[model samples]
Target chain A: MHGQPRPYWNPLVAGLILGLALLATFLVTGHGLGASGLSARLTAALGSWILPEATAANAYLGGYVKAGAPLAGWITWEVLGVVLGGLIGSLTSRRFRPKVEGGPRLTPARRLTYAFVGGALVGFGARLARGCTSGLGLSGSATLAVAGFVFLIAFFAAGFLTMRLARGAWT
Target chain B: MSFPFYDSGFWPALALGVLFGLALEGAGFASARKLTAQFTLRDFSVFKVMFTAVIVAATGLWLAEELGLMAPRSVFIPTLYAWAIAVGGALIGAGFAIGGYCPGTSAVGLASGRWDALVFIVGMIAGAAVFAWGFDAISPLYWAAPGPKGQTLDQLLGLPVPAILVAMIAVAAGGFWLGSRLERRFGGPIGSSDVTCGSEGAQPPETGTRPGSMRPS
Candidate 1:
């Protein structure tokens, strides 16, 4: 218990490290890190394999099917890498634990429900905006993209505003 | 212009993305409690990591672009589409507050052995599917209120990349300074759980300890 895990790195230091990583990606791959798009592609592919007709007929998903193996897409692979990388990081950092994180009094089921609903909303919202936090907020701002700033402000503002509604999650 | 693998291949890109993801998770971002502390004005972790990354990348890209090693255009930035951005940002924020994870973080959490992360990922995929099916009806909104696309700060304000990059670094520096002060005033490390225990890991600081709760640490 003495070493349940470690403290997080310095915020400024961590941010600088991430910033340089993004820069490296731009220099090397000419793109930034992304996760949502890849997941979308995978979803489309799985949908296609399970329900080919439906996937092909769906307006948004059909494009991905027509484009070929969705899993082969760049973002898809990158997202996979994200999962793998995360697992490795947790393992190395000694933070790998199987548990449901929620408010002190919240049940696992309630936490799961909120997680699903929140995730769906995030997905839909990310699609509408053309990206999510990492893609729009971080990568976007790194390039000084105006949309990046807008999304960042909006994201934080809404989070704070809606935070009260979910007070049970905190003390 | 002389970088060997501007288009090296899929493996490298994937590897780099994985490294980035690992870095984010390793920094304690995989936990929603950690990320949301930013808005609660409790912890400065998110701001610290995000701003630092921006500064580092901005400076690196600026220097590379200046030296002609990189053509910034290769990186993609979406068009403004104000309504979409606003609506989407709100939804994402709601998700963050409710689920304590983002698209990137949900994936990280899933990897880190959280069942909720899996649920979130599945929901995200389903949500994406729903959006895709409704794309035709939403097409207009997707491109509404179009702002600049892939427009960098240097290009927009007619400032040199170096100058703009330097300005960004300065802003981050200022933010860091303020964040530290807020943490001190806030009573704990900005985002640590209030019910502190000397458990397995080093827990984050508790919230509402600050004089003014909305200090934006």
Candidate 2:
């Protein structure tokens, strides 16, 4: 959708901006950016609406619904912001377009299939560990959360292994 | 005092989250190829942006805490557990490679009109369900080695937070340098052809195509 593959801003500069944003978050909100937790919450809310009694009884689903208004929660808003932010960024960069993102040698369907499988694993892992890369690895590290460290190790190890297996997808 | 306005309830947090997400999009971080470039050692944007933000925020937090403006204890910190993190991280990493987007990025991807991102989102939700259902069976493994919520690298290594943060900044710089060099070495020929998505004016390089490297004529 854009030329020059849409020039990227300098990483250092971008990082600095992100830092300020985070700092602002801390100052006004006393926290950091997060994504996965809310996704779980949304899932729980939907599950409950579909089967209130069962969802309420389910351990994980129960936690999110019992909390009430999963979509109304702070993290969920942040996620909404992420969506808006991404759209704006892509549009401004002239890089916005609807397409399947994947490697060569793969059809859109295949790429999407892999995306689904991979995303599922990530979701499971994030929930299993109580957080994903953002909550555990990034935010956790920011606050010196020990579980965050372990998550970093496990996540990277898995990525490396999967990368090897998915070599053809990339090449 | 009593910051984290949303923590007090919900609306404020949701607003803040959207703002943050907007910021991420503005930063052009929603793209998967851009993120994976870090792994290929071609682009260090991820490290650069992530560490810069971490260091800057850490410094500000430290200053706030030192000034007694904010109680460090009040700040939320993820409790540490070796086992849960290890297994979770590995799986997440694998998912990153296969899916080309993390939980956060997938949202961005979806916003940018990527149909595949939707699929990934569905997959993630399913995965979370599976994990939640199996939690009862895996309870023991999840709780292994619990520690103080704020236990960190500095504490474990006997270094001060500020010092460690500085070291991290330096490390990030080094990574960026390496990434640039790799890009120069591997970036295929530029302008070979930009793939367009649908009728979009001009498609940026698709996932498989490496930037900064020469594209085969």
Q: What is candidate 1's lDDT per residue for B1-217, written digit by digit as tens?
A: 5542456367877787787777788677777666666666566777778878877876776677668875646566656889998888888988888777889888888887777788888889888878887888998888788766566666668987778777877877898788877766654453322322323222334445566554432
Point out where model 2 deviates above 4 Å. Answer: A1-6, B1-15, B188-217
**Once model 1 is optimally superposed onto the true structure by TM-score, how far is the C-alpha of residue B52 displaced, in angstroms?**
0.8
For candidate 2, lDDT tens digit of each residue in A1-171?
245346556566766776766766766666677788876886787777877887788876786677777666667767877787777777767767677655556777787788889889889888777788667766766665666667766776676567666756654
State model 1's lDDT: 0.74
> Could you tell me the TM-score of candidate 2?
0.88
Tens digits of lDDT, candidate 1, A22-119: 87777676667777787678778889988999898887888889988877766766777888888888777677766666655566788788888888
Which parts of model 1 have CA positions greater than 4 angstroms off? Answer: A1-3, B190-217
**DockQ of structure 1:** 0.60
Q: What TM-score fits each model?
A: 0.89, 0.88
Q: How accurately is candidate 2 docked according to DockQ? A: 0.59
What is residue A30's positional error in candidate 1, in angstroms? 0.7
lDDT of every predicted structure (CA atoms): 0.74, 0.69
